[model samples]
Target chain A: MSTFYFIAFLSIFFSILVISAKNPVHSILYLILTFFTFTIHYILLNAQFLAIVNFIVYMGAILVLFLYTLMLINLNKESEPVKPFMVKIAGVFGGGILAVALASSLKLVAASNPVILKNPDLGLVKNLGKVLFNEFLLPFEVSSVLLLSAMVGAVLLATKDPKTA
Target chain B: MESLTNTIHAVPLNHYILLSAIIFSIGVVGVLIRRNAIVIFMSVELMLNAVNLLLTAFSVYRGDASGQVFVFFIMALAAAEVAVGLAIIVMIYRNTNSIDINVLNRLKW
Candidate 1:
């Protein structure tokens, strides 16, 4: 119980740092820490397969890609463009409205009783694989196409066109 | 090994919902306030993850693996998004030498 609270606190704390940090590199590092806490959360939920995948995919692959992008862009001499004061206030107000609405709606509804894990091994890779292959075969296959298209699109977008200039 | 689910049972689903709500709002605010394209992109990732957490929580409590499966798909989608997004950001930098949202407003002009 205390461990869950502590880890959740760490997740929120690191995520706050991820957003508030001025340096992009610092933000990415903190985001990595935040995702690490989430991995712990998955473990707490007994989702071992998802936990490992989140750790590798988020911390290992995606964030390193972010770091690479930062390295590609020369951020030294160029100054960051700051939003106007009014725009900042508007943004805060809009998000505040959303949060308030969600909170109030939550308060109005009676929460159902939380259930214990009836099958402790439900989250294991074995069961998840059974469920995935049996029920979600199409989406699973389609995701590969999504990956291929995304890869091709990224390569195409990043490369300079020979005919343009 | 002792099962952590017993410990997690001490925490309520409402608490997870609230925590995810907070995280999601923070992501929203980050997206709204930040001008850097990469930070905005990171904030979007943060939002996706908050939903992911909520889905996993529900998955565990209900003894259903479907939610976790969906979470996996979302992660795959996010990876693809970041790949294409960062590539576009790099292209933006090459073309305009700036990754600022304000500068990106006039897309066709």
Candidate 2:
């Protein structure tokens, strides 16, 4: 097998462990590994800018927040309860159906021809930065507004009850 | 025609598709099976990532930049999703000390 397949297998394996792990903290840590693998995949795909952003936003900021949240709710023991076996089986069935449907639809919907650019080395960051600033400017700014609103909303929710203080 | 076919067989699109399918299924399983809100959220991310993988594979097969652009948007959306999702999880945790999504049904009037 190729290195790509090896990395891909490792990514899938770690992500599965992430969801199945009982400890929330451990799950989050595993999720970091999952994100790292995604970054590798992005790099392989020549999306250099996205890989860096994944490292910074997901591994750096989001995982830190996950750890902080885990620390904040330090219960005496693990809090999430396990579901019954039947429910799990049902879940597997439901998820299976969805996956099959999605895959089939994509296959049926014939895609357009690939457009491999002659200059694949046009630095992703530079090109994306130009695109963001030029054509995608409005949407980019709107995203900032959306993020600020989410931040404010989170703070409001956190401080709603004085008793929790 | 035989020689052309032999040369074209080097890159298999099926491999990428199969891998994407597995990732998507894993995400779906996590969402359906787990009760923890965080894990479910992560599973959702997994599903999104799986879709992104499929998009990338298709883009490569077809030689399109648009698929990569779509992946870019998906990543932005995933970050936004995580921010909102984590906040909601925090709120749910404070209201009740458990992240078990099964109990979220009790929030109904």
**DockQ for each model:** 0.77, 0.32
Which residue pairs overlap in candidate 2's backbone?
A113-B62, A114-B62, A114-B63, A114-B64, A115-B63, A115-B64
Model 1 ranges with Cα > 4 A deviation: none
TM-score of each: 0.96, 0.83
Worst 10 residues of 1 chain A by lDDT: A109-118
**Clashes by residue pair, model 1:** none
Docking class of 2: acceptable
lDDT per residue, candidate 2, A11-127, as tens digits?
Answer: 889987987888878888898898898887666656667778778877898778778777876644865688999999898888778768767766775553332323463327776
For candidate 1, lDDT tens digit of each residue in A1-165?
888889989988998898888888899999999999999989988889999999999989999999999988988777677888998899888988887887777888787566467788888999999999999999999999999999999999999878865
Best by TM-score: 1
TM-score of chain B of each: 0.95, 0.86
> Tens digits of per-residue lDDT for model 2 on B29-86?
9988998777788788788887887786666556555566667767776666677777
The lDDT of model 2 is 0.72
